[model samples]
Target: MKLQNSYLADFLSLLFPQLCPACGNDLVAHEKIICTDCLYNLPQTNFHLHADNIVARQFWGKINLETAYALYYFTKGGKVQNLMHHFKYNGMQQIGNLLGNIAGSQLNKNEKFAGVDYIIPVPLHKSRLKERGYNQSACFAHGLAEKLPAVVEENNLVRTKATQTQTHRSRFARFENMQEVFVVNNPERLKDKHVLLVDDIVTTGSTLEACAIPLLNIPGLKLSIATIAYAE
Candidate 1:
């Protein structure tokens, strides 16, 4: 009966074949979001191995974070951008999950991220969350936790105010605008914990640093950051 069920499932799948999210190609037997070629060809940053990488330098003189890395290099009108479009606009939450899991596997090979106690995603405001149906960054964090095998905490950070989108803002403006936007959900619970802070992409990093400031102020708390891509 189980074999019959498997055959029936295959027949139904053939009736409505799956397509890859990255290239819109036919989905392979083991594929979910991306095809093997796109997976192999996507640009990777490999920023974790070096401590003083440019991506990490964005945080310098700011929060004094423990470790920072991004998995891919984002280019305008490029494949990474296309993937992000699907991730955000196409409701391809699984694509973010795939990126996060892939990046997490790379991070898993490094010992730097092993001691993470809790994963904290840069939170979207409640109103926006209601509209979007999901926080893309949180989806990535969930996938990371699965790959890293750690527990993730949601809504531990809240966006206190809605601000203008950072895309149109200057770096300094992004910093100033985002300063009062985030507040840690519970300071007491986070104290003395090595927290892994996550986001979908790091552009000016003013947003990440803005989010990090309030969290880092918690006594004995350590901050590390990860993102799917670094806009270079």
Candidate 2:
């Protein structure tokens, strides 16, 4: 029966081959959403290993963070950007899950990410969530929780206002736009906990800074950050 199943699977695959989102290459049996070569060639930042990484530096003086890491560096018209497009807009949420698992595995090796009590993805407003049908960051967080000893906490930190897109906005303008956009619903749950906040990408860091302000206000809350990619 096992041999027959394998043969049937191979036949189906030949008829309907799955292509990798990153490279558009046919995925072999062992591969999933991304081909092995594409995964290997991903622009990993290795930021978890360095305390002074650029992502960490972005929050300096603006918000206090225990650590910050991004799995990959995003460049315009690059493979990471393609992957992100598919992950965010093409309904390929599994890409986020896969990348988060990869990131979690890397972060697991670092001592800084140890003892994460809760994983919280930066929330999307109701209108955006309704339009997207899912929060991409939450998908990443759930995948990260699978490898890390942490719980994926949702609905606690939520978006109260939906602002316009941050594209082409100045850093200060972006920061001003995000002001009061988020609120902590149950502060007690996050109080005194080491929270690992997550997002899909970080550019100017305004959105994250705004999100962190309320979270940092919670008593005894030590905050760290993780993301799929960092765009310079």
Candidate 3:
């Protein structure tokens, strides 16, 4: 009976195929949100092994970061970008978990990301959270926690209010807009711990910087950053 049900499900899938969100191709029975080809062809950045990669260089004199890493390099209209679009705007939240799992597997092999005590996602404003019905960064954080030793602290940091859209702003303007936007809710849990700050995608990293500033104030707190993609 179970075998018949499995076969029936496969037949139904064939009739109503679920396409890969990133590639717009038919997903195989084993494939999830992203097909294997798109997953394998992702422009990966092996920054985890190197301490002074491009991501680390971006923060050079701006913020005091222990290290930074991005799993993939993002290009406009590319697979990573499409993946992010679906993950962020298309309500495909599972993409975050899958990508986070891949990132965690990679980071697990690197010594730099080990020993992280907390995994915190950059928070969305209450209004945005309500509108979106979820925080995509938190979804990624949960996936990372499954493979890493750190605990996901979703409420530790939060956006104080909604800020203006940053898409067309200059780098400095972006940073200014994000200034004073994030506040730490629980400083006690953050103090003296190494935290892995996460987000969906990073361009100039202004948003991550804003999230990091409050975390930086925690006594003995060390900060490391990880993002799904780095838009170069």
- Give the alpha carbon lDDT tens digit for every residue of 1-232 in model 3: 9889989979998899998887889988677788999889889998898898998898899889999999899998888888888889889999999988999998877776878999999999999989999999998988888889889998879899799888989999999999999999889988899999999888899999999888999999999999989987
| Model 2, residue 186: C-alpha shift (Å) | 0.7
Candidate 2, 60-84: lDDT as tens digits: 9999999999999999998889998
Estimate every model's Cα lDDT from 0 to 1. Answer: 0.86, 0.93, 0.90
lDDT for 207 (candidate 2): 91
**Cα error of candidate 3 at position 134, Å:** 0.7
Highest lDDT: give the candidate number. 2
Off by over 4 Å in 3: none
Worst 10 residues of 2 by lDDT: 106-115
> How high is each candidate's TM-score?
0.92, 0.96, 0.97
Q: What are the per-residue Cα lDDT tens digits for candidate 1 across 64-101? A: 78899998888998888888888987788988788878
**Candidate with better lDDT, 2 vs 3:** 2
- Cα RMSDs of all predictions? 2.0, 1.1, 1.1
